[model samples]
Target: MTAITINFNNVLKLSDDQFYQLCRDNPDVKFERNAFGELIIMSPTGGETGKCNASMTADFIIWNRQTKLGEVFDSSTCFKLPNGSDRSPDVSWIKLERWNALTSKQREKFPPIAPDFVLELMSPSDSLSETQAKMQEYMNAGVKLGWLIDRKTRRVEIYRQGQQKEVLESPTSLSGKDILPGFVLDLLFV
Candidate 1:
């Protein structure tokens, strides 16, 4: 099903607590808040998409476990970005120092910080342009590196701060570059 976006600007804007409560009240629905205070209600991913997401998350988890350089989060974790948008990247990582700097309560809530690196895998129901825009938003919010992986097209769009997106065609793997240092994403399963 196509995700539904509701414009909440006409209504009294919800406070941060109210918004978080709304999410808590609906445990099954996935929700996102845009910079404009619009609410995005997304449908659950299909089986194939879930499998790919799990693979990607596993890779990040393994890398983080070995390197002990940062904290890794799956798709369920939402982050309150500086621009006042709450976003949940498919896979995200924050530097060790940055993660340690957050207060326990902030860490428990949507930790108000942009991730150092993020990944977005294209699902069948997702629109490419929308995903691209989301990646750009991440970059604008101070993400050091972001990857928009399109399994169907066998392509990847790499987003980085202070640079244009770099596209790659049908690569076997993706290097983490300077940001992830020594980390690489194997695209075979993707």
Candidate 2:
């Protein structure tokens, strides 16, 4: 039998809580643009984030090993900000102290929190502005650091609380001095 899709534009009628609740309740459901007033799932790499996500996951582990400060979250799991938005950063980190502050239940449920740092890697089909807006949202929600990595240009856009966006192009490495001192992201893969 053929399946029928509902219009997505009506998604805004729901509070962010409702949408995620829907996601939780129906894990098998596929949300699409204009099919329901919602942000549609665009990742087709068998994951929401793509190859860069895989690379970042490796970087996350290296950072954790060196700094011994936090844990990394995968895209399969999500970090839900307090503002009713859910974003699975390509890879994310939560400081050990703050992460340990949560109850077992809080850890199990959507974090209702933001990561200490978030990273987004550009995909061929991604909307740059939408991604930028999301990065801003992460900052507004108290994310301490963020990175927007553009592979095509071999550039990285750094986001911090007080500094204006810093663009590093054709760079040899990426750092986490203030965020995760001594951690380095070798751009050799890009």
Candidate 3:
């Protein structure tokens, strides 16, 4: 199923702590909040999608381990963006310096910083328009690099700060470029 969005800005507004508590209270539910304070209830991915996500996350983890230049996070980690939105990408990374800058509490809770790189792997239930909008939000919130990968279509859209997004069709791989030197994503396995 696609995500369900609830607009409660008129009747009630949830503070950051309230949102966190809501998530904590509902451990089975995956949640996100838009900049406008709307709540998005996300469904769990199917087996194939979950497998793809795991593989991609593992790739990031391995790369980060070798480089030691950043920390890699899986889909479960929600981040509080500068635009007041709480988002969780399929995979994300933060520069070592930027991650070290966070207070212990901030790191313990929803991180209050944008990731240096973000990746969104579209599941069957995901809406392309909504995912694209989310990617734009990440870029606006200072994400240096982002990727929107559509496994079904075998297409990828690359987002970079201060540059228009580049779309690749059935590419064999993706380069991290200057943002993640020596990092290349092998789309063949994905």
Candidate 3 root-mean-square deviation in Å:
0.7
Worst 10 residues of 3 by lDDT: 181-190
Best candidate per TM-score, number? Answer: 3
Candidate 1 regions off by >4 Å?
A: none
Candidate 1, 70-163: lDDT as tens digits: 9999998889999998999999999999999999999998899999999998888888988898898999999999999998899999998999
Candidate 2 local lDDT, residue 25: 80
As a TM-score, model 1 comes out at: 0.97
Best by lDDT: 3
Please report how far candidate 3 places residue 93 from its true position, in Å: 0.2
**Candidate 3: Cα lDDT at 71:** 95
**Residues 83-165 of candidate 3: C-alpha lDDT, one tens digit per residue:** 99999999999999999999999999999999999999999999999999999999999999999999999999999999999
Error of 2 at 139 (Å): 0.7
The runs of at least 3 residues in candidate 3 whose Cα sits more than 4 Å from the true structure, single-residue gaps closed, are none
lDDT scores of the candidates, listed in order: 0.90, 0.72, 0.96
Pick by lDDT: 1 or 3, better one: 3
Compute the lDDT of residue 184 as modeled in candidate 3: 93
Give the TM-scores of the predictions, in the order they appear.
0.97, 0.80, 0.99
